[model samples]
Target chain A: MKARQQKRREGRDSENALIFGDSVRKCKTLGVAKRAQEEMVGFMLVILLVAIIFLIFLGLASMRSKSNVRESAEVSQFLDALMELTTDCRITSFSGSVNPYKTVEELIRDYDRDLTCENGEKARDVLTRTIQEAIETSWVFSPESLYQGYTFEVDQTTGSGASSTQERIVELTWQGNAFSCTHAIGDTKSVFSASSTIKARLILCLSRSE
Target chain B: MAFVLVFTMIFFGIVAVIYTSVSLSNLREQVAELRERQALERARQLTGVPEFAFTPISCSSCIDFDKALALKQVRTYQDFWNIKFLRLEVVYPTPIDKDKECSLSVLPPNCGYVDIIPSPSGNIKTKTAFVDLVFWDKNKGAYVKVLGRVHISAFDVER
Candidate 1:
């Protein structure tokens, strides 16, 4: 009787061990599945962020291109208007009476002439005054913005082109042509005058103030 | 895993659609701008032409209206239609932005029947340029302000 009772006890113990082992295996599988789901969520989030950044970049590039196009058009129009502008600077000489205004493209053309006026004004002095006056009389004149500045330059490109484009610096007032700081030698970018078929080189620079 | 893959595909698809639409709309604006730019170049060259670039001993930056009126080189209404599209408005008395609209093409016989002009017959895009100027009317015996105002038009086609 004692031997039979011992055999029953061992059978019961073996059955309980098998049931626990099966449950342990199921738990391990569930843990692995949960981890994989978490990893997928992270990957999806990363991809979403990357796409958003790319879109923003595209938007910025488009905006930049539009702005560049607008600026170029403004420059073209300004140059055309400048060419169309004429000043009535009729300088009279004693030979008879010369109508110099006809061929004179701009009043600022007198800058190259070394002639002195009877009033003791030098050519350079006249240039300074004429330039100031031209800005006021210009049809396409715009009030200078705080963030933008402009420079007008003239070069003797009768043969080739302006030898150098970068020289001279001058400051201007925020509203218009008022020079914030005065320079004895004004910067010349290039504004050409046409006397007959002769073509002069003219350049204007627009820069961001900042 | 299947859900993740599906969600990713849908998100990327939405992004692509948005990007394409934005680019297409901007593309139209860019084309219109390009046409305007081309017109601007033509206007500049027009001023440099011998007929317009003449300067008498009494004139300065002045365009001769008489010479321009005598331009017989551009004949047919459809032939010189390019010139007809050119607008020259004068803004001397007024501000540049408020330039008066004027074009030699507005003369009788040259300024009618838009359908006959060059186009594939569809919705066309157009832009107007307000070019400022000073003009000398040799016939009218007075100084008139003339500005170049070009109405650049274009029709799109898939290349």
Candidate 2:
């Protein structure tokens, strides 16, 4: 009976050791899985941060491009308007005197009287109104913007062999503002005048019926 | 620990030397490029002029022509075009008396010449040996045909 009791005690001790070993292995596995999960979370957070930074930079670049486009368009429109006015001035009849206007305001008034849009009367009215508004909003009479008190004398007049005549001359001063600047100090002026002549004439065409 | 510290120091020293070398080389390249650009700009400034250099054949022909037309020629052209105007004075060279009566084409073209004439109306289509002012009428923007066969020519000479 003593020998049988000793065998039973030995068997119980061995089983307890096996169970302890299994418990240690399970703990090690759980620790390794926790470490792997932590590293994966770290990598995901880094990727997300980089993505957000890239998006912010792209948005800023897009906004900058848009602003540049707007500025360019404004400059182009202003230049176009000035050119149109110059062309029209080349066509108007300067009757009373070569020096029609002493100030920019006078020139603008004359320009307003002469220039009409190609569209119908309503469209022409809208354009004239817009130009008038631009004149009002901007300092069209600033000394730096224009050369004041310049002389315009008749250089030459030619009569066609026919009944009418044409006149041409160089004006020392031009009234339109050629340069537009975004900054107050950086504005420039266009001092050059058109090389082409302005002609006015009255013609009576003979009708076949007459 | 001591060996570990020494190794780390050596590694960082290598990285620092490499970075400094790269930065210095990049800065030198930028400086060289800027100097080259400045030299080119100065050269262009000196070569550009109004009289002989401003022509269609010049490498910078377009820019020179635009400036001449926009600044000098336009003003003069406008003055000539004004109605109620009568006289125009253009500078002409003194007549060169060559020994031989050369054909019109054989003589070196007038080095520079000017013609002064009474201004005529641009409306009538008559051929007269006179310079006339052309203007846009309220009805027609075209200059009436007064001066016949107008041509412009220019040449570029090396500075």
Candidate 3:
């Protein structure tokens, strides 16, 4: 009679709360629930990891883009200013009298417009001075500065009637660090009438400041 | 529930602070950079002014100041460049070093400054250049070392 009464109590307990009871089906259900919860946590962690990595990469790309824009603006303005400068070099071939002051742009524009001096030697001094000044004023690549190095080149593509093209480059004032390297290029083209066009390219490389 | 709420608030607060700091720093850097560019542009444009200009239509390095026409030209520049304050000081003849804030208002035009506009007050953006100036000074009777210094002050930034 006592054993029969104990069995009835056990049945009552299992019916009331199957989740915490010693019922066979209920135990299996609890095991599955626990495993599902673990998997859900793992998935959530993976999602979080991916989101963090994506955000970091996106931020890095944005910084790089902003840096490039700044460098591009600097280079473009610098080149424009440099080209507008007047040189002591004379371009008196076209006009009757000797006009002592002619800018780089003027010289390039009138390169093929019946110049008495076919060789670019007359304007070499002006080109050299302009390039030297540009280099001197430019940022030097270092741990402190955002700029690494720069190369300013002017290629007299069509105007050079000589044997070859007239290509000139400014002396490099800076060298980049090993880790971070960047380059920004700004171009200027001058076309006079229909004869010849002068193309000039300015490149600025930047480094991530430490 | 209260604990969870407090923890979330703290996390978000930290994130907000961090985000704001980064944004503010970037903004400050950009503003500083813009100020520099503004000064550079103004200086370049000064080269284009015929009164302060030489041979080339626009030459940044060669600035020749004409005493007769400088004041009028400077006023035109004040309008063109939206300049608040413009000061051009020249030191003619190295040995003499005849340097002083020349009052263009004074008669006989003894002052060094064109004095088109009065000096601007408050925050200003300034750029100086050691450029070549071809000035004919009757007193000196020669083209000496006339250094051109241009100081430009833009409007005050409200923020």
Candidate 4:
């Protein structure tokens, strides 16, 4: 009886050791899989970060290019030339055999003074007609044209500092179609009078045709 | 570990290539823009040249039509400017005669345009700028100013 009891106890001890060894192997396999999953997640995160950075860079580059396209030297030069153009509107008050005609620049200065031309036309009326004709002749705004639309504005500001008052002397606008413009190239020229400042601004809007 | 290292190297190599290409393209655009600006500056400077500039008045952007008419007579200016083409047109008062070219003999009121340098036979691009065309009007007995358009083709030598 004593021998049989010792045999049974040894058998139970062997069985327990075998079970523990199998469980340890299973645990090792699970740990390796878990580590692989963590590594994969880390790699994916790094790729995401790099992709985000690249996208941001591309966005910034496009924005910079767009802004560069908006500032055109041609438009600025045109404005300068427009200001110096001598119009047929001769100011009778300053009429001489030499230079009775007032330039677009001078007309802007005299607009506020309500001066009349030698032909008895108002300075403002002559200015508006001159600007309209010049712009129409220079830039043909049609659907097929590169310039889809344009805006020419003249503003007069009187007084100084806080007492300044701004008035719109002339505003002319033309559009080719209903489509919104994608970009605008614009420039402003300021002509100072004795008592006021006259500002002339020209903006050319561009649209891409389908 | 070796697999991860290889993948990372490949990824970084692609990123570097993309970055380099983008930077190179941007640089090319900037160079093109600079070239255009230089050409425009050259055109603006041409207006202030003594041969064409209006000297009597304090006008900086004025081109004397009288001087330009005389310039048309001097054939030496063609090669002196070294430009492909140079033309000026009066835009205001509707240029009484559109076909007539202004010269020392065919003065303003009779002529509409001046061909300082005639157009070369080829597909060439031109840059245009606005200027004040001023001249002493013999009829009006005073200096007359009109809208002028200056069209200049690219220079022969890169400038």
Candidate 5:
């Protein structure tokens, strides 16, 4: 009987030791999985931070490139000078000792009045010819040149405030290259008449070299 | 652990240095652009001076041909402008004699340009802009406005 009791006690001690060993192995496995998950989260965070920084750099670079192109002062001054140029069209009203010649600005104003020049040419036709000649002489648009194309437009607005009606007097476009224009610079000048306002706009399209 | 900390610190230091260098280069470019814009503004201001502008027509962009020719004779204006070179040229109406220079006796149809201040000897680059040139036309018996160009060059002073 004493031997049997001792046998039973030893069996219970061995069983408890085996159960503790199994639990220790399970805990070790769980700890290793938790550590691997933490490492993956840290790596993802690092990658996200790098991506954001790259985007910011790209944005700054694009903005810098955009700022390099701006409105040209030369174009604006050219328009101002072009408007004051005198044409050969002389108004019949101003005759005698001092025959007054109409300037480009004046011709635009007299266009609506259907005025006739001393040479019997219509004011509209004279004005168009003069402007065409001036533009052709001034700008040389070619693929090799800085400018690829150009557009000159004139608009006349009649009446004041909200009742004003805007009409296009003339639009001239010249393209000298098959290459696509990368940029454009332009300016506008306004001439006030007795009953209307005339606005002249000149836009030059630039090639890649510009 | 100590080694990792040192490596991280060194990496960040390199990044910071690169960022600073890039920023400094961009600032230098901006400074150069500003200088160019300032020079252009100074050139434009030349037209606004009373000595060059056409006062009778009250046109801001018009330069009186008579005034420009007369200004060439005055020696005092040379020191006042402090520029290396100045010139006014009629580009349109296709002057009959392109090479002929304008004087009091020889006018527009006979001459193409007037040298208000002749070019000084140097490698200085010229800046030019379009302007309206108004002159009295004896044949037409009225004032005529022609397309003109103004050329200017500044003296090279070390900044």
Candidate 6:
């Protein structure tokens, strides 16, 4: 009878040990699963952060490209305006004289009167404004834009070309910087030039009377 | 352990953001620089001498203080040339004699007049006749001067 009791106690102890071992194994598996989930979440968050950064970069690149295109178009417009102004000067060959207005305002007035567009004055104004802006903007890059140089010469005719005189030459020099470059928005500039006859000729004619 | 992992992730996220902003700003600056160079090149190319492409007309006024006038046109071989005013109007068709048309005698006698005296060394002889009158040409680049011999009678104004 004592032997049989010992056997039963041993059996009970083995069963309890088995149950405790199973529970420990289950706890280990649960811990590993929780760690893996945490790692996955962190990796996904990193990818999302990277994606956001990429999007921002893309947006900035797009903005830069657009700006470049706009600048090119502006430059093209300026070239066209300059060509038109130069072409207008060719008329001097026919009239044998130039008009007196050399200022931006005078140019605009003449342009407004002569331009034949449906938009007429408005179109001329716009073109003049564009040229003015370009010239002014050039100063932003180089201050000496307008100070290039001027040459003056005068010839006098008397007694029906029997005699003539050559007058003195004048040279003017300027030393200064007038260009201003700004990276900020809302800054602007304007430029325009009008036709003017050489003042030297008039001065010479007047002097001949003396 | 969880704290260590979160901290690592946060560190990487900050680095990525900084890297991206820097990259974008650098790209923008590069683009701006390239555009500026292109503009400068364009400016240089525009420096050539522009050809005579169009004429200013009918506007009554041109740039450079020049005036547009309704005058006869004269054709020239080149676009630009100096005018050698000739008295030979008979070379072209005319409705009236140029001398009769420009009768300076209609002015009051003794009006301002200039005399031409030519010496052996000079191009003209003494008592030479000359006139002061201006003519316009639509083709010539400058006003044509009416010589004295062409209108000798007009040059004899008593003034």
Best by TM-score: 4
lDDT of 5 by residue, B2-49 (tens): 444465566567767888998899798677656655665666666789
Docking class of 3: incorrect
How high is the lDDT of residue A199 in model 6?
18
Q: Considering chain A alone, what is the TM-score of candidate 4? A: 0.75
User: Residue A129 deviation, candidate 5, in Å?
Assistant: 2.5
In model 3, the clashing pairs are B102-B111, B102-B112, B103-B111
Q: Per-candidate TM-score, first chain only?
A: 0.44, 0.39, 0.49, 0.75, 0.68, 0.43
- Cα RMSD of all models vs. native, in order, equals 10.4, 21.3, 8.6, 3.9, 5.2, 24.6
Of the candidates numbered 1 and 6, which has the greater lDDT value? 1
lDDT of 2 by residue, A1-210 (tens): 999999999999999999999999999999988977876676556556655865685687568644211122222222222212221223224453232211122233333244333332332234334334333332233344431211122222233356445433222222332222112111111322233223211111111111
**Model 5: CA > 4 A from native:** A1-69, A92-99, A158-165, A176-180, A193-197, B1-37, B156-159
Which candidate should be chosen as best, given lDDT against the real structure?
4
**Residue A134 lDDT (model 4):** 81
* Model 5: residue A4 alpha-carbon error in angstroms: 10
- Which stretches in model 3 have alpha-carbon errors above 4 Å? A1-21, A24-29, A32-69, A72-78, A96-100, A110-121, A133-150, A156-210, B1-24, B42-64, B67-69, B72-125, B128-149, B154-159
Arrange candidates by lDDT, descending. 4, 5, 3, 1, 6, 2
lDDT (tens digit, per residue) of candidate 4 on A1-210: 989999999999999999999999999999999989888887888788878987898898788766423566667777787777777777656642246777888888777678888888888888889888887777778878778888888888888899999999899888742223576777778886888888888878776521
Candidate 1 lDDT, B12-99, residue by residue in tens: 7987898799889879867875765665555455455675554553333344543444443344643443432333433332333342
Cα miss at A66, model 2 (Å)?
A: 2.6
- iRMS per model in Å: 5.8, 17.9, 8.2, 2.1, 3.4, 18.5
- Which candidate number would show the highest DockQ if scored against the true structure? 4
Judge candidate 5 against the unseen true structure and give its global Cα lDDT, from 0 to 1.
0.77
RMSD of 2: 21.3
Tell me which of candidates 2 and 3 scores higher on TM-score.
3
Candidate 6 CA-lDDT value: 0.33
Interface RMSD of candidate number 6: 18.5
- Per residue, candidate 2 scores C-alpha lDDT tens digits across B38-145 of 433332332244531333322231122123223333335434423222111111111244232222222211111222122344632211111111222235333211
TM-score of 5: 0.76
What is the lDDT, from 0 to 100, of the residue B145 in candidate 4?
Answer: 76
